[model samples]
Target: MDFKVFTIIATIVNFLILLAFLKHFLFEKVSNAIDERSNNIKNTIDKTNSDREEAKNLKIQVEENLANSKLQGKNIVEDYKGRAEKLFQDIKKEASNEAELIMERAKKDVEREKEKAEEELKKKVVDLAVILSSKALEKDINEKEHRRLIEDFITKVGM
Candidate 1:
């Protein structure tokens, strides 16, 4: 190759002009596009983290609601059990009172029947006594006189 001073200087000047043009037009636009893409990626990551945290909080709230529902169900069952026990006790007390009334009525009926039987026996004894006295005093009395004497004796004995 021929070593020419003027040609070397001209080539260096052309290369410097091309570098300045590329820096002003192509490089500047490319660098701005790359920075915009990096910013978009960072915003998407932050949004994804926020959505994941919201989902975790929702899951915790649902679990707490489930536990509260279970406790309410248990309380309802206990209330029903207590009401059933109270109803059973009331029925038992009513049955006991009815049985006592029946026993008292039975006792009154027995007492009335005993008194009626004693009165019937006393009337029979009175008739027997009158017959025996008439037989013992037979010879001393006429028919009309005997009847009047028996009436008088019965009146005195009744009093």
Candidate 2:
């Protein structure tokens, strides 16, 4: 063979041997490493997506709970308002009842006072009439005649 041909053939044989050796020893291990790294990346991305979804669900649940709590608070406030109104009405009723009772008692007291005043007035009038009759008769009678006349007047008035 020519020297150039022999050198080229030798170079080609060397390259083929190197390729076979790399295929047998290095390719599988390197490819397996790359595949493992890719799988790890995919798993990490999937876990991140699932975590995000879980966080969103938790936020929604929290919002729902807050809304329910607000509704409950509103209900409690309304209940309190109704109770307060009822209490106010009850107080008004009680006050009115007390006022009526007081007015009735005052009226009874006034009626009793009027009756007592009328009796006192009747007694004064009777006394005044007796005094006036004595003055009117004083000038017209001697003592014995006054006694005799008074007995006659008394009998006629009694009859």
Candidate 3:
């Protein structure tokens, strides 16, 4: 290389000026754009993580609510079963009481019928005794014969 002092100095100065211009205009714009893109990517990642965490919390809350609903359903079913059992018992007790009343009424009716039959029999016996006494008086027997007749009548009534 033939060393030219003025040309070499001028080329070096020109190259430094070009580098300064590229740094100020092109490199600075490219770096700013890259920094903006990096910031946007970081913000997107953070938002995605936050959203995922929120979804997890929501899932947990929903599961707890479902468990509570199941417990409530079981309690409701148990309450209905208890009510049904109580109703069945009440019906059975009522039926038993009705049967007892019917039996008691039937017993009273039987007693009334028996007493009525006894009254009718006693009335018939009294009428027959009165008729027999009148016929014996109409026969006009002697005292000893009358006594014998009365004794025979008494024995027939006893039989």
Candidate 4:
């Protein structure tokens, strides 16, 4: 091989010019493309993290709502039970009052019947006494007239 110093110098100058051209055009575009890709990846990662945080917050809210719902359900059930108990007491009191009214009415009925029976017995006794008196006196008068005379005499003495 034949070595040429001038040719070597020319080749070195050509290589430096090619490196400068690549740096200005191809290398700059490649670096810009790489930076754009890195930015896109970072944005995607930030969005993913935000979505994950939102999901976690939603889960926590759901759990809290479920707990509140259970508490409200228990309160509702307790309220119903209290109302039922009050209703039961009111019904029992009403029944008791009704029973008392019935007993009082029954007692009044019994008293009325007793008084009626006593009135009937007094009338019968009066009738028997008037007949006996008429028979003992040997009066030929009707029993009714004799009883009327006795009644008039008693009334005059009493007044």
Candidate 5:
């Protein structure tokens, strides 16, 4: 094993020069590319996070709008129900008033009819009394004859 010191020194110097050349040209460009790629990946991740947050906010807004629509629908239904109930009550009251008016008219008609019948009855009684008086004057006012006249007058009045 012959150790040559000058040759070893020359090889070390050559290795150092090759390392410096690679670091200045190839290594510098490769490092720049790696840094650019890392920055692009970080920007993409940030954009994705922002998009996800925006989607979540939009979903919340949609849910709130849907809830509001449902509440409005319920309110509309209740309002219509109230209107219908009021209309029904008004109609019922009007019908009751009409019925009362009809009953009053019927009562008045019945009263008028009863009064007319009573007037007719009084006139008939007066005519019968006059006939009895004339017959009594033509005959005598005896008890048996008077009783017979009353019986005939009663039978005629009944018929």
Candidate 6:
């Protein structure tokens, strides 16, 4: 071959060796670094999504607890109302019983007073009759006639 052609071939071989070295040393390391950065970004995104889901679950749990607490409060109020009604009924019954007892006692006291007054009246009537008979007998004395007059007075009085 010619001298010029030999120089051109050597220069082409040198350019190919330089391209191979650049591909092996610089391009591979830069590509690996880029891949590692992409993987880190993917991992961070997954972790953020997991955290958001956990927050959502916690909110739902809190709402459920609030609803349960409200139900419990309502139940407590109903229970108290029932208890109060029962207590009021018991008090009313007791008052009614006491009033009945007081009325019965008053009636018994009135009956006893009536019996006492009747006995006193009967005794007074007997005494007055004796006095009247004694005064009349001093003027006209017959024992049978006196007894008959007293018996007639007693029959007219009826007691």
Q: For this target, which candidate reaches the highest lDDT against the unseen true structure? A: 4
lDDT per residue as tens, model 5, 93-123 = 9999999999999999999998888767755
As a whole number from 0 to 100, the lDDT of residue 10 in candidate 2 is 92
Best prediction by TM-score: 4
TM-score: the better of candidates 2 and 3: 3
Q: Model 1, 1-159: lDDT tens per residue?
A: 899999899998898989999999989999999999989999999999999999999999999999999999999999999999999999999999999999999888988888788666655555555566567756544556655665667668773
The list of candidate 2 runs beyond 4 A from truth reads: 1-17, 20-25, 126-159
- Clashing pairs for model 5 are none
lDDT of 5 at 11: 96
Error of 2 at 157 (Å): 17
Q: For residues 128-158, what per-residue lDDT tens digits would candidate 4 score against the true structure?
A: 7688787888777777787676667555755
Candidate 6: list runs displaced more than 4 Å: 1-40, 136-159
**Better candidate number, 3 or 4, judged by lDDT:** 4
Report the Cα lDDT for residue 38, model 4.
Answer: 99
* Residue pair clashes in candidate 6: none
Give candidate 3's root-mean-square deviation (CA, Å).
Answer: 6.8
Best-to-worst order by TM-score is 4, 3, 2, 6, 1, 5
Q: Least accurate stretch of 10 residues (summed lDDT) in model 1?
A: 138-147
Our model 5 lands, by Cα RMSD against the true structure, at 8.3
TM-score of each: 0.58, 0.64, 0.72, 0.79, 0.58, 0.61
Which residue pairs of candidate 2 clash? none
The RMSD of every model to the true structure, in order and in angstroms, is 6.4, 7.5, 6.8, 4.5, 8.3, 6.1
| Candidate 3 regions with alpha-carbon error over 4 angstroms | 127-159
**Model 1 spans > 4 angstroms off:** 1-36, 120-159
Which is superior by TM-score, 1 or 3?
Answer: 3
**In candidate 1, residue 40 scores what lDDT?**
91
Question: What clash count does candidate 2 reach?
Answer: 0
